[model samples]
Target: MPRLLGVDIPADRPTIISLTYLYGVGEKTARELCHKAGVNPQARARDLQEDEVARIAALLDKDYTVEGQLRRQVSQNISRLRDIASYRGMRHRRGLPVRGQRTKTNARTRKGPKKTVAGKKGVKDLR
Candidate 1:
């Protein structure tokens, strides 16, 4: 594995693909990084030379917000929303879907497992 910005990129994968393992880096950004760093996008990460790795790292540090920086930025945005009491922030704070997904069904991922209420069947039986 090639360590870039404190994250180990998979050595067996193409450099462009491996770059996606870094947070905030996707296919397009990876391609752009390769172009700017003069690194071969198709080259496996393990085959990269020290200078090439340094170039990539330097470019990332200078031009991109990634890894921990990106994570903190996103969390800060969410917290700002929460502080302002936005609807989306409320949803996030309540652990509910924030994208207007129907909660009538198929929201178990956010709502967690069902908490079934008892006594309905017993009331019907008594009647």
Candidate 2:
């Protein structure tokens, strides 16, 4: 395992794929990082030399906000929306869909489990 930005990247995977394990780094960003660091994207993480790892880490630290920082920034954005009481914020407050997704049928993931309601009793039961 190679440690980068406090995350351990899988050793057996190619450098391009392994770099994506770090938060805020997707496929394109990983490739760009490899290119900037002069590291071979096709090489396995386990095969990388210490200097190469250090170079990659240095590039990421200097040029990007990743991991904890990225997570905090995103959460802050959502909080700001909530504070402003926007339509989307209201949806978040209510735990409903915020992106115009219909709640009539397919929002089980956001709406949670079904709550059963009692149906009308039969005439025999009324007696």
Candidate 3:
């Protein structure tokens, strides 16, 4: 295993893939990072020299936030939404869908479980 950005990358995976295991690093960004650090995309994690790993870590620290930094940034984004009091922000505060998707059918995951409507009975209570 190679240590990059304080994370142990699996030995068998290529450097590009290994870097993505870190939080907030996706496949596209990983490839870009590898290029910026002058690391071969095809290079295996275990084959990486210490200096190469350090270069990669330095690039990540400079350009992107991972692990703890990424988490804090995400929390800050949510906080901003709460501050704005926009329609979407209201959805976030109420724990509903932020987008304008119809709640009639889909979006059950966010809209939560469906409620049974009493057909013909109208608004009558079952008791």
Give all TM-scores, in the order shown: 0.86, 0.80, 0.68
TM-score ranking from best to worst? 1, 2, 3
Q: Is 2 or 3 the stronger prediction by TM-score?
A: 2
Top candidate by TM-score: 1
Q: How big is the positional error of residue 64 in model 3, measured in Å on the Cα after superposition?
A: 2.5
lDDT of 2 by residue, 1-127 (tens): 9999789999999999999999999999999999999999999999999999999999888999999889999989888999999998889887788899999988999877865658844647555
Candidate 2: where are CA atoms >4 Å away? 110-127
Give the whole-model CA lDDT for all candidates, comma-separated.
Answer: 0.94, 0.92, 0.84
Clashes of 1: 0
Looking at model 1, report the run of 10 residues with the lowest lDDT sum.
118-127
Error of 1 at 112 (Å): 5.2
**Candidate 2: residue pairs that collide:** none
In what order do the candidates fall by lDDT, top score first?
1, 2, 3
Q: Which candidate number has the best lDDT?
A: 1
